[model samples]
Target: MSAPGNPGAPGLAGNSGSPSDRAAQGRAARKRVPRSAHAGWVPSLDRPDPVAVLERQGRDRLPELLPIRYGRMSASPFAFLRGAAAVMATDLAARPHTGLTVQLCGDAHLLNFGLYASPERALLFDLNDFDETFPGPFEWDVKRLAASVVVAARENGHSETKAHRAAVEATAAYRTSMRRLSRLGELAVWYERLDADTLLPLVRSTRHRRRAQSTLTRARRRTSLQALGKLTEVVDGRRRIIQDPPLLEPAGVPDMAALRKIFSDYRSTLSEERRLLLDRYRFVDAARKVVGVGSVGTRCFIVLLAGRDADDPLFLQIKEARKSVLEEHLPSGPYIHPGHRVVAGQRLLQAASDIFLGWMSGPQGRAYYWRQLRDMKGSAEVAGMSPTELTTYARLCGTALARAHARSGDRIAIAAYLGGGDTFDHAIAEFARSYAVQTTTDHTTLGAAIAAGVVTAAPEV
Candidate 1:
């Protein structure tokens, strides 16, 4: 498809190079691409068949995609629809122009943004989901965010016009905010963030005002001491994970013989100083904990660490690392190891990450990254948020998303492309509306599949 404004020419939003340079880059990137290059990739909007696209990808990766399958079992028809990324990916592949790319949160839905305490115990708001995060077209993130607004609005029984307005508002915030960042110096943009207090004034309505107040209240309650109280329990005179069935299960301790060997290699992944620092904490126990709808099945494990005194405790989560969904669709780049990718991406995107954030490649070649399990972690209650509260929350997500993008790319060029206009706002609204319809249809197909016994739900206890 031709770029948004130009006839017979594709647009790259931030391309400031000469026409020849831009043409050469585009040609080089697109040339010699395998048909299968687009095989697992979603189709462009000019050739829209979201259903077919989803089916193609689903058939290829059902086994890998199974972990994100749990919450659908008891969800509403619409909620079930909201959780289908495999299906959504195909629908998204079919959509239109403006190929400006960024390191996207990949799954930038409303619920993914929230409050998390930094290493210094300062609670801040930021993007909390990264399963689908990687470099790809910026429009993909916008489309996902906008469509989520529609789904959320529909669930709250709002009119399509109201939902559309919220999506438009969100896109406008992104465009306007990106332009604001583009004008700032690099250091200014890097240090910029929407801390909770700074964000409170942005809540426009009474409902949002109330919700923001409640959110702050909850965040204040989530101290490290509170996390220890909630996530730990005494088991036979030893502190252990309290079993909660599917949501929170006791993973049990790792095999002593296997762990002694594995940890030697694990120590090699740390810096010499960090390895020495870790030597202070004795490994007590470890267990698997299922977390989030999209990340449920991946091998997520928690390691319990303690000092000489059991009261001095630390919890760490070591989740499995895999290729990003964006990697399958975007142009290839430098081959950084996946563990390095996770650590670097987290450090770049988050104002600060867990102090323990580091990667280790096991003897079996499995890559895992370790981080504080819930270092004062909390999220905005999307289901509990009113429509106005959701809108305010969406704006927070958009603002944080723009800050993350500004870190690795030129904001000035991005600002020029957006040009303080409603073009992006209108375009994304169209995409969101269309994609939300597609999500509904795909959700139905998944329900049908479950009914047909094609995919089994994890047994409900």
Candidate 2:
């Protein structure tokens, strides 16, 4: 792992050089690695099998849950892409990068950008998943976003031309937004955020605006109190989380005891004020929960707490943290604990984060992070989006990503590297289109493995 001076660590300060000198350095980097060089994606002959990569990932995860992850990934090409971060990280590591570091949402696919409540209770739209976040070149995130866009567009039955266009427009938005943010004061960039309420005005059509408003309303309604009736039941005169096999189940006596112990450990990581506030909420119930595509096999649980009365509830999720998929491919990050790495990365990348965010070590020395389970969280329905709507959403995601990168990366250098041209955007479009094809091929390979009984896959749920 990298030591104290590494830029990948949390609390990274900005480049010390003057703006003009940084800009010149960015320009100089172009001679060694031109922006246009990102145009193609020809898979190497010795590229590891995608299924083998997934199997290797599952080795450390829950054995029974591995089938669900496979089942989820096999549902669609986009689903495979969502669950195949390790595959993409390997491919990206082989490509030329500009060497400009940023705290990456290592799995920055289309669905990963969403709406969630900030600490101040304002609904904000930004990157919501950070399981694979690590420091790497800025273009890695852009390429991942563009590739997901292209894959989503194709899945929506758009022509290849339209898919390519959407990817180009997304990268273009990232470039333009970065350039605009480069001129902003440091504090202004740090404070920038996308308010969910303000997004209604940006929707062009009446139908889309209504959908946008509906989404916002649904997000606001997704609080822990709202989830209480659905996720819990009054059992034998006691309030407890409902047990549903394979998805949600009570942790047995041993696991429950471990959870209770770690619950206290997690409290120590919070601020004194938060610790005091948490002390008021008595622990009520906890259940293992399966969440997300790529994160499916990891150990995850939801703990319910009550304040004052049984009516007032709080749901906190404790998710297992492991070495990032990017770690092996890139230089090691500074964090020794995976949970600390995830929590620190989230704080560095998001505009405003969940106040309940904390981390601790769990049983068997596994690292885990704790955060609210359902605090106004919602993601876009990418599969149903129209071509125009997809393009607009792409722009929103691009802008949000740039705003995040600006906080931890050398935006002036990245903007200068992108220049005032469409070269990088077009290059990324080409790469996305090529990668989308590779994703489909890999998806087929996984399906073939399932058919041949080489791997087990649970029925789609």
Candidate 3:
């Protein structure tokens, strides 16, 4: 780690480094890692089998839920991409990086960039997932976002031309956004955010504007108060989380006792004010939950809390946090605790985070993080998006991603590396189109393994 006032430190986006110095460093990086070198994808001869990679991840996860993970990944190319971040980590490690560090989202796909309520209760669009977040090359995340755009475009039955164009525009948006941020002061950059209400004009079409408005409206109604009616019911005059087999179920007695201990410890990590706010609620019920395509099989629980009365409820999720899949490929990050790594990375990268966010060691010393299960959170449906709609959403995600990276990385350097032209954008778009093909092949392999009984996959619910 560099000294506190060191101007040349890797991640000093603005505080210590002179504007010209950081900008020059970014320009120098382009020579070592040419913008054109980022194009295309060719699997190395010894590339790890994608299914085997997933199997290894399942070793420490719940065996019963492993089938759900495999099942979800086998759904479509876009679904496979969501679950295959570890596979992509190794692939990105194989390529040369420009060494511009950022607090990466690790899985910066289309679905991961969405509308979530800020601390001020204003709806903002930004990266919502940070399970694999670690400091590494900025372009790794850019490449992931670009690839997801192409995969989603293809899955929506769009032509290759449309997919390629969407990917290019997405990368271009990132580059342009970064260049704009490079001129801002430290505080201005840190305070930057995209208000969801103002995003309609950026969509540029009446149909897309309506769709954007609907997404924002849905997100606003996703608060805990709204969730109470959908996720809990009165049983014997007491509110309890409704049970749904496999997907949601009451925790075992032993697990329930352990969760109480975990929550108690997590509260200690919060600010005194947050702890006081939390004390107003009492733990009411807890249920194990299956969530997300890639996150299935991980130990996850949703705990219902009540304030004053049963009608006033709060839902918090405690998810087991293992070492990020990026750990093996990237250098050791600052955090030794996996749960701390997640919480810290999330705090640094997000525009505003959940007030209830905290972390603690679980039973058996396993790391886990806790946050609101749903706080005005909503993701766009990428399955049936038209080419134009996908392109617009892609651009939105790209801009959010750039804003996130700018917060932790040297925005001036990255902007300089991107230059005034579209060279890097075109390169990553080419890479996205090529990687989309690779993802399809890997998705098929998972399906083949399921058919051959090499792996079991539960039927989609």
RMSD of each: 6.1, 2.6, 3.2
Give the per-residue lDDT of model 1 (tens digit) for 280-332: 99887766666656555666767778876887877777777666555654555
Better of 1 and 3 by TM-score: 3
Rate residue 118 of model 3 by lDDT. Answer: 88
Candidate 3 colliding pairs, count: 0
Model 3: per-residue lDDT, tens digit, 385-451? Answer: 9999999899989999999999998899899999999999999999999999999999999999999
lDDT of 2 at 209: 89
Q: What's the lDDT for candidate 3?
A: 0.90
Candidate 3 colliding pairs: none
Backbone collisions counted per model: 7, 0, 0
| Per-model TM-score versus the true fold | 0.82, 0.97, 0.97
Taken over the whole model, the C-alpha lDDT of each candidate is 0.63, 0.91, 0.90
Once fitted onto the true fold, the runs of candidate 1 whose alpha carbons sit more than 4 angstroms away are 1-74, 77-82, 205-207, 246-277, 459-461
Q: Kindly give the stretch of ten consecutive residues in candidate 3 with the minimal lDDT sum.
A: 1-10
Candidate 2: Cα lDDT at 33: 69
The residue-level lDDT of candidate 1 at 241 comes to 66
lDDT of 2 by residue, 131-183 (tens): 99999888899999999999999999999998998998899999999999999
